[model samples]
Target: MGKEQEKEVILEQMEERAVEEISTHDAEKSIEEKLVAVQEEIAGYQDKMLRAAAEFDNYKKRMERDRNAAMKYAGEHILREILPVVDNLERALNQGVVSGVDAEMKLAALLEGVQLTLKSLLAVLEKFEVKAIESVGLPFDPNIQEALVMEPSDVVPASHVLGEFEKGYYYKDRLLRVAKVIVSSGKAAS
Candidate 1:
């Protein structure tokens, strides 16, 4: 081969190699850019997940605080209503010891005051949806009445409530206390 032709061949080969290297470099740069973009997307998703978790924790803590407050303040309204009755009883007792009144008169006055106080208390209970259970003359119910004794009676039928020892009460559709009563047995067996 001639010298000039050989040199020209070498220069062409070098130019081709340079082009391949530049193409390879561009490909590597493109891949690096895509990697950085994918990493940024992952970081953004992680930040969102962390924020959601923090929000859920805050929600749980807020609910717990509200529940505790409700528990702490429970029955406060009922006790406030009952306190006036207590005050009335105290007033009655204080005035019950007035001088110049006879013992019998004082006793009567004190009893009247107690009756009024009891009526007031009962009214408050009624306001709060408390009601007395009717057991006398009704058939004995195990759910609301407790049988104290069985007595033979001509008037009351068997398994019927004859007399109540203590009145039962219901507080807002729920039983507060069971009625204690005597059940009657049908006329004695001959």
Candidate 2:
């Protein structure tokens, strides 16, 4: 081969090598750009997951707060209903003492005042859905009455309530207290 031809062959080989290197470099750059885009998409998903977790935490806290409040005020309605009865009793007692009447006169006057106060208290209790459990002369019910004692009696039937020591009350169908009562044990009158 001649010298010029050999030099021309060498130059052509160099040009081809340059073109291949350029093409490989362009492929590497495209791959790098795709990697960056995928990373950005993953970051967006991570942010969304964090936001959802925070929202769920807030909802749980709110529910807990509401539950605590409900428990704290569970008997508020019942207490509010009974306040007026206490006030009426206080007023009756104060008025009876202030009159300064004789013992017999005072006793009669106080008795009447107490009856009226009791009636007013009953009215208030009824308005708030509180009802007195009828324990006297009725069959013993464990749910509404607690038997304090059983006694031989000529009144009513055996196992029936003869008297109530303390009144039982119901608030809106829920039992507030059980009545302390005496039950009858059938025996002939002496």
**TM-scores for every candidate against the unseen true structure:** 0.77, 0.67
* lDDT (Cα, 0-100) at 168 in candidate 2: 99
**Candidate 1: residue 110 lDDT (0-100):** 81
What local lDDT does model 1 show for residue 164? 93
lDDT, residue 93, model 2: 77
Residues 1-190, candidate 2, lDDT per residue (tens digit)?
A: 9999999999999999989899889989989999999999999999999999999999999999999999999989878877877887787677667655777876777777789889987987888888999889999999889999999887668999999999999999899999999999877568
Candidate 2 versus the native: TM-score? 0.67
lDDT of 1 by residue, 1-190 (tens): 9999999999999999999999999999999999999999999999999999999999999999999999999889889999989988887786679999888988888888888899989999999999999998999999999999999999999999999999999999899999999999978887
Cα lDDT listed for each candidate: 0.93, 0.88
The clash count for each model shown is: 0, 0
Q: Point out where model 2 deviates above 4 Å.
A: 1-27, 62-77, 100-105, 123-129, 171-174, 187-190
Backbone-clash count (model 2): 0
Worst 10 residues of 1 by lDDT: 87-96
